[model samples]
Target: MKSGHSGWVLAIARTLDAYGLSHEDIFRQVGMDPEMLRDANSRYWQEMISRLWCTAVKETGDPNFGLKVARQIRPSSFHVVGHAMSCSATLGAAIHRFARYAKLISSSAMIELTESDDQLKLVLAFDTGDMPVLPETMDTVIAGLVCFNNWIAGENVPPLEVRFRRPHPADAEEYLRLLQCPVLFEQDEDSILYSQTDMHRPVLSADEQLASTLDNMAVTQLGQLSERFSRRVRDCLLQQLEQESEVSRKATAELMHMTERTLLRRLKDEGTTFQEVLDNLREELAYQYLQRPDCTVQSVSFMLGFSDASTFSRAFKRWTGRRPSLAQHNGTAEHA
Candidate 1:
């Protein structure tokens, strides 16, 4: 149910413009803010985007609007993910890189790369069951992958088969024509199967060092919009916790390449202090761990940097106004 970036709205606007329709008007029709286009960091509820896609289809009277939308994709539209893809050593490298950082493009969806004896399948799907991308949205995603890879590899890297969850439209001809390969519909999943030969094809623009560098930079930039300063500190703490080390503000600040004062100031601007964010994350994570039947209170305590199981039990009661055992009981009941 995570929100996607503002870039999608702007891309939709450009697509609508081709049909003499106003993208802003369409956005407003869906009760979304057209002003969101101004900030790449701005996001819209996933449901609004579902509505926007439906509205855009009706307004444009184009069954293949999704394909048209795919055509409008520009390299800059994908941000650092695009650059990293372009610099990958081979088409396989590019596709893998794209999958690795696909969340930077849209958190609602994910790209899975699977290998077969003679083929490689790239499956694009909604990672979360609750917020599935609309059928038309999948259309853009499938075609968009083909279009992106073609451009990045400096050739038309058509797939052996393209599968869609939606049924065939009256005008799938355009889709077939644009894809330069077979376009399938009413399939079990949304995917593109590339031949192994195509998978190994060299990316015309490959640069190993530069691609690695851009990926590093992109990781730092992606997902920053939602949590801002708090996310950075949370990430630092998560690393320390994973390493079974104590979390401290000085260590977190140093890991972020910032002074403690500067980190504290930034967190304050986000309406939280570092300790607050850390505890909030810890509490949320604690609840998640406790809700799992296999996790023990003592283990959860250790993960949260508590001195003992009793200390964690008291903190959990304070955070949720109930004992950890009570929460676990409720969770088990809900599942039952």
Candidate 2:
């Protein structure tokens, strides 16, 4: 997670420098040592950064004070990563690329992309560890999305819709001004929605070489989600199911050194059930394996711990409402 302070510190510093504000006066008002900004490495501490941002806005009486600061920095400050995204085939592809390669940019937020029948959604979920204070946190989310979309497309996005997990604050009017969209409050998820028509509007030409290079890297990063769990545990379960190629809940529970009752309870506490985790892991591993033309459906079924190809087929249908082959076909269509 990015330290909340880092975003604020950078914004504040840039804002002060741009407006030619009395650096001493602003720093004192924000209760920050001006010298801290001189050292590029000092911005990692999030709490201090958050405090600096809040103090600056309160003292300066500027709701968009931070954005005003950001306006002054050149797009070139973002380097090659920025250049690559700016040249992406379309805003959708750029966002997808950004979400996949986000660690190269910042660890503060987890960017997620989801597609459904009605709309495509982009979510920038902030880490609880580096929680930004109210308005600034909210502002940053709105501003960053707007700026990113604009920069990539070389035009304004003016998002079609915005939703926030948090309620509207006093400065809600200002948020509307920045987002230039219909802002919904207290929604089920904090996300921005775009029409599918926008997804395929190509901005960067298809470069086989570049796409392949990025795909390999993105998949490698995506695979790290598995590392959070012990490989030994993951491997053991995967191996056990390969022979019989399927196991009941009781069997899996016993193998993991817990009773079925306890396992169910624990998984619930973690905001996931056994079936949900199993399905998620299965889907991910399936995607990984299905990438190879030589990978057979029967072989993939065995690897996923399904008793037989039939059972795997049923499960795959349930997961994606299509057979494995068709799902892969659909995946290709979506990416294309």
Candidate 3:
């Protein structure tokens, strides 16, 4: 699947150049044609991204290469999505929005937000079957989220903890120092955890009016992204779910420019249905919204498109086998 923007390849190039290494050579060595990344808006395959990371680590001889690469991400790297995030009302709100629109970043991977009693966990899960999550790539994502939030807040907002699925690196202390939090390795997932209360901390760059405008632009652009048919349908549901509007099969099909029957047939070939896709999207988003300290059951229910809180409550219970209110009390990561 299309993994990430060519801007990522550009970011890798810039990082390597900063370290006095020939990034173009590394790009070519990894079997990536330099011309493929010439257009910043074009996307490269996920396997190519993985291969580039593997090559970069070996040539640079730096276990901390991904951290260095993350530091180089400016707003331009993320385009309008970065603008929306920077102008969001709060750190948590920005991150939440990012999760909702993360298909803007990678088609094969998704960001999930969850919280326990005291900590908020941002989990990075990839859907690239049979493809291992590269440690270097994991570092870049975790570090990028940390760095971006701190940039948005205009101050260091250290995470409560950082967890990685990869084994400990030789330069683990760098992760600790940069994150200013305990960093654990070989965890069940790659996640960044912050105190639940830290989520409401106001962003210094926030301009809600501008943020609202940018968010609308993002939603329109999000639906236009080229991706798997099911994923495109899933993106449609995300917007409807966020607006508290019903995700009707007819509406979804219309958005995708296909007849309802054709859309359903395509989804079936993709091993899903419109209703199944909508329910899964809501369930995933429900955990993300419920985990935030500021979000209430009523607010979350509305955001997820249920007619009323009670209906959403029943659906949430069906999805999690427990109440959404109680999800925050459990330390275990809720699987979507």
Clashing residue pair totals per candidate (backbone < 3 A)? 0, 9, 0
Best by TM-score: 1
Could you give me the TM-score of model 2 versus the true structure?
0.51
> Residue by residue across 259-295, what tens digits does model 3's lDDT show?
9999999999866688877876676567557657777
TM-score for each model: 0.66, 0.51, 0.65
Q: List runs of model 3 lying over 4 Å from the truth.
A: 33-38, 116-118, 226-336
Model 3 has an lDDT value of 0.77
Tens digit of lDDT per residue, candidate 1, span 1-336? 345667755677899998998887676545466876886656665556666787798888777788888887766556677788889999988888778877777767677788977998888887544435567788887787789899987878888999888988887878888788988889898898889888889988889999999988877866465457676677788889889887888888888899999999998987778877777667656755765777777788888898888888887666545566655625442211
Question: Looking at candidate 2, what is the lDDT of residue 168?
Answer: 60
TM-score of 3: 0.65
> Candidate 1: misplaced stretches above 4 Å?
127-132, 222-336
* Candidate 2, 1-336: lDDT as tens digits: 133223335555667656666655655432345665554423333333454566567766775664465453333323233445565677777667766765443445577888877677888665546335455555565566567666556666777798887766656776677677898877777778887777766654445467556566545644543342333234545556556545556777778787888877766754556776566457646755665666677777878877777888887666545567654523442211
Q: After superposition, how far is residue 163 of candidate 1 from its true place, in Å?
A: 0.8
Better of 1 and 3 by lDDT: 3
